[model samples]
Target chain A: MFNKIYAFIKRDVTIATSYKLSFFLRFFGMFFSILVFYFIDKLFGSTATPYLMDYGGDYFSFVLIGIAFTSFLWAGLKSFSKVIRRGQMMGTLEAMLITPTRISTIILFSSIWSFIATSVTALLYLAIGGLFFGVDLGSANILSTAIVLVLTIIAFSSFGILSASFIMIYKEGDPINWLFSSSSTLLGGVFFPIEVMPDWLQSISKILPITYSLDAMRLAILKGYAPAALTHDILPLIGFSAIVMPLAIVSFYLAVNKAKMNGSLTHY
Target chain B: MVNTVEYSIETKGLVKSYPQPRNFFEFFRGTEKKPVTALDHVDLKIKKGEFFGVLGPNGAGKTTLTKILCTLVLPSEGEVRVNGYDVVKNGGGVRTSIGLVSSDERSFYWKISGRENLVFFAVLNNHSWSRAKERAAEVLEIVGLESAADRRFETYSSGMKQKMAFAKGLLNDPQTLFLDEPTRSLDPNAAKEIRHFLSSLSKQGKTIFLTTHNLAEAEQLCKRVAVLHRGRVQGVGSKRDLGRMLTRGERLMLVVSGLEKPGISRLETLSVVDSVGVEGLGGGRVRLTLELAEGSVSTVLSEALKLGLQIHSTRTEEASLEQIFEKLTTEEV
Candidate 1:
């Protein structure tokens, strides 16, 4: 399993680096996003701090963690299906499927590189924010942050697996991907606190795991809260995982069989 | 179920059908669409170490049968067993026991080296890292691609790509190897190389199930073949067996000289001769065409000589696979 994962990551890394400009542009794009937010932080000044007091009372720091962690959210949500979509277009998905490997394993191995790149970029966000932009890292509770990140990824990955199920069958334009993903960016507190939303919108936000994910992440990383104090956020993330993971698995299985029956496993 | 000891693949009343693809407007209108049958009530059994071919024209369900046996697709009805394991029930077992060499050339990661792609697939087969590399090298050597193994797949010519696909299929040393148009788009020299490799595999006691529309390729490579047309198995047997089944007898042309109508009448009346026709060459000689019952050529000729006919020339015609395929697939349902 480790070999498969390593081989796939290596395979992707080679392909990704082969396009020299695109390879460098990913990091360039990462910092470009940070620059825009930094300027936005300067413009807002201290106006947003009142709502951000729970996360160190600094807009830049709060927004930095929000964007950095949601990088993981997007990775967990989009990585599997994106790779699958590319595979379908390139005909590599059928090549992998004909092997003895399980579909779940193939899904994991195919996209492990995306998560790794996300992790690297997320750490760069932290390092850049801490060194140049004055974001706090000294008070971070690493264990609580790890637990929240793991559960957050699991919750978000359920939606990804569901999205992949659609790609496996339809080959493109997976409906729920656009739905949950856009919903995450809009309501999951990646840019602003969900607490600022109107009460009805906040109610809708509560159902998305990312809302809990970012809330728990800020408390643990900025305020250094331990797991016990983070349970309120952790519980909902767990709840989302329990509900959606099984559904995603079942949907993926059905989608695969449907494609098999249609004789379109290799069709795009 | 295949006995597993004597047979490598067996299918009983196998059928597969796919739903017609709907357009955007049709999907919204909720139009009821018909399913297109790809394979219809096909039955076959292939012995262990036997080379079997499926001869078909395009859209003839040859690839569908290959996918079903590879467990890449499931049959809508009936049973298929490969290497003693039911394809739908124990697909993992069947997958582990068989290799598939597909004609689709884009199946590899084009940006990666051929070696890397093979190593990746070998690992998927559950080999250790060291073993995977070793197997990759071994198969690369087998396909005579060792020199090009380190080059990117996109750099390969068509022949090299086909050979790379063939090498990947041999990684696990599967008991039964399925080749779907393995030489589909290759040049003659490349096709001959693939055929030679396949012949060597067959000589080594590996069962091969090949699908192709190339009649001569099948005749050269397979010992027994099944003819698939319009989603049905029109005939299944050796070339001779299919010929006998379709024509129902042997065809013989003979040149003989005898004083006319009475001899033709007597020959037609003989039990071995199904029908007889004589045409005079205007020089006291006639061309006698005879359709003899299966295995009755000797009997008919022996009886002809006893009747005091001076035979000048004789020729026997056995139907070619192409002719038999044409007759089987093109005849009205």
Candidate 2:
């Protein structure tokens, strides 16, 4: 299993490095987006949003954490389906499916490199925020932040595997991608606090695992909340992972069987 | 109790059907679709260490059968077992016991070198990193790609890409190998080289199930073959047995000069000749093809010489594998 994970990471990194320009361009793009948000935060000054006071009272810090954590969430949520789709297009999916490894192992291993790359990007976001934008994280509870990040990744990966199941069966035009992308970005508090939304929308946001993940992460990273103090957010994220992971796994198995029966396993 | 099965592959009444959309607007109308049967009912047994060929034209379910045995696709009905493990219930066992080399060329990571691709697949099959690299190197050498192993796959020619694919299949040293048109896009020399490699592998006690449109290659490489036509097995046996099945009598071709009407009439009158065809060669030469009953070639020739026909050349012709395949498949269609 460890060998397989290393092989997948090596393969992806080799391919990524082959396109040197694209490799550098991705980081450049992320940095430019951060600069845009930093300038916007400068224009808004420090006393604008009162909701930010609960976290760090700095708009740039609030939005930087939000952007960085949501980028991590996006990577975890889309990596499985993206890998499946790319495998189908490249005609390697059937080859991978015929191996002795379990389907769940293949799916999980395929996404680990993406998660690691996203983690590095998230750290870069934090470094830029601290150095150039005056964002502070000196008092953050590191252990609590790590726990929230791990839980959030597990929870979002479950959703990603479910989305990949749809791609495996449908082959094209998977509605799961659009549904999750729109709903999660709009209500998961990536750009702003869900508390600012209408009452009914806030109720909807409460149901999303990403909403709780962002909330817990901000509390841990910005306000230095301990694990015991953030049980309200951590419990739901854990529950979501525990329940959704198995369900998504079962759904992925069924989708693979369906594709096999229909002789569409390799069809793109 | 353990089951002891002699055959490497066994399929009884295996059937596979795929659902087809009713029409272009079926999705909008939500209409019920129909199923198209890819394999009607295939029953086969391939012995251990035997080189078996599945000969068929396009759309003959050869690929479907291969896929089912490789455990990449499921049979809609009946049972399939590879290495004595049920394909549906114990797919992992089947996968571990076999490897597949498909005709599809896009199955590799084009950006990576051939060695990396093989190593990656080897690790996926549960090999350690060191073992995977070792196995990849060995297989690349076996497939005559050792020098080109480090070249990116997209830079390789079609035949080189195919050899790389073949090397990947051999990475695990599987007991049974499923090759679907392994030489489809190769030049004649390259195709011959691959065939020789497969023949050597068969000599090493590897069971090979090869599907090919090239009848001569199958005839040269396989000990037993099954002819598939329209998702059905039309015939299965050695080349001689299939030929005899299609043509129960022997065929003899006679080239003669100074053939006359009386000579033809006399040859037709011979009791051993079942049928005779005469084509004029326009230079006082004629070609006579005589279908004779068993053990009648000598009698026919003697009778022809006594009738004043000067025979320049007499040759016996058995139906080639291509002829047998065409006859069997076309007759069924």
Candidate 3:
């Protein structure tokens, strides 16, 4: 299993880096976005906002973690379907499935490179912020942060797999992805605190895994909260994972069988 | 292998259909349209070491059959087994025992080297990394792509990419290999190279199920061929045997000398002779073309001898594969 995952990752890395200009452009764009966010935070100055008081009241640090981890949300919710769509367009889906490798294994491993690349981008965001934007990570709690990130990925990946199920059959126009992505950006505390929203919208935000994920992440990283103290966010993320993962797996399984029957497994 | 079963590939009553679109009125009335049947009741059995070709025109369900046997598509009806594993119940087992060579060259990553592609596919087939590297090189050499193996796939010619596909198929050393239109769009020389490589693989005693529209390729490589038309198997037999079926009406050409008008009639009266055409030669010798019903050439000869004709030479003209394919696929068939 590890061998197969490594092989796919190597293949993607080779292909991804083959586009030399696009590769460099991505990094440049990452820095550009970071700088844009830094300036906006500068306009706010050192003025403390009540919404961010729970996490050192630094809006730049709070929003930095939020926007950086949004990439993870996109990776989890979009990578599987993007991989499938790319495979279909590139005409590699049949070739890949024709191997003895199981379909489930392919789906599970197809997004590893996306997640890994997203992690690097996320880390780069934190590094740039800490070095130049006056954002401090001296109080970071590594272990608690790692646990929340894992659970967050699992919870987010459930939605990703479900979106992939729709992509597998429909070929395009995945509804699940748009619903989660737009909602997560607007209400899941990515660019702003959920507390800043009205009471009704905050209730809606409470149901989203991203809201808990971002909250726990900010508390752990900025406030240096211990694992024992992070249970308030940890339990809900685990519950979401426990409930959604099986549903996603079963949905994907059904979608694959339908594709095989429809003879559209390779059809685009 | 093949569960000790003699046949490497087998199918019974196989059927596949694609759903059809309905009109607005039909949709409103809930009238379901009949699906387009791609394969209708195809029954086939291929021996473990035979090179079998499924001959068909475009849209003839040859690829559908290949996909079903490869466990890539599910049959709407019927049972399919490859290497003795039921395709539906044990697709993984079937997949493990078979390989595929698809004509779709876009299947490979354009940015990677041919060797890199093969090694990755080999890994997918459960080969250890070291073993995959070894097998990748071995198959690349077998396909004569060693020199070009390091070049990116997009830079390779059409022929080279097809050969890389072949190398990938051979990575697992499968018991049964499916080649779907293996030489679809190659230049004549490039196609001949692929055909020659296919001949070598056939000699290695692997069961090769080839789907092709090229009658010459099938005739040259396959021992037995199945002609599929309209999602149905029109006929399945050795190429020579299929040719014999085509020749049933006009079986042989007998050139003779010293045969007269009376003798031609007498020879025609024989029960085995379906019809006889006599063309006069200048020196009172005539060439007789005999179409036989159910008798040996010797019987025709003896009967012609009784008619006081001199036999010069007899030639049994076999129908070309093209002619047989045309006969099988035509609507009249």
Candidate 2: tens digits of C-alpha lDDT, residues B1-333:
123368898888889999995655887798886788889889888999999999988999999999999888999998888888899999998888888887788889999999999999999888999999999999998988899889999999988988887888887788999998899888999888888888899999999999999888999999999999888989988987787676556889999987778877887787777678988887788889997776789998888787777888999888899889989899873
lDDT by residue for model 2 (A153-222), tens: 9998888888889999887666766776788899988878887799999998888888988888888988
Worst 10 residues of 1 chain A by lDDT: A94-103
- Between candidates 1 and 2, name the one with more favorable lDDT: 1
The RMSD (Cα, Å) of candidate 2 is 2.7
- Highest-scoring model, lDDT: 1
Q: Which pairs clash in model 3?
A: none
The candidates, ranked best first by TM-score, are 1, 2, 3
Report the number of clashing residue pairs per model: 0, 0, 0
Per-candidate DockQ versus the true complex? 0.71, 0.80, 0.77
Worst 10 residues of 3 chain A by lDDT: A44-53
Show model 3 residue runs off by greater than 4 Å.
A45-48, B1-4, B21-31, B247-250, B254-270, B274-290, B298-313
Model 3 score (lDDT) = 0.88
**How many pairs of residues in model 2 come into backbone collision?**
0
Candidate 3 lDDT, tens digit per residue, B1-333? 134388898888999998875777998999988799999999888999999999988898987888889888899998788888999999999889999998889989999999999999999999988889999999999998999999999999888889998998998999999998899889999999898888888889999999888888888989999999999998898977786676564467877887777887887887777778878776867777787754467788888788777778888766788988999999545
Task: Give the alpha carbon lDDT tens digit for every residue of A39-153 in model 3.
Answer: 8887973663776889998888988999888899999999999888988899888888888899888867888999999999999889988998889999999998899999999
> Is candidate 2 or 3 superior in lDDT?
3
Segments of candidate 2 deviating more than 4 angstroms: A45-47, B1-4, B22-24, B28-30, B255-275, B282-286, B292-313
- Each prediction's RMSD over C-alphas, in Å, is 2.4, 2.7, 2.9
TM-score of each: 0.94, 0.93, 0.93
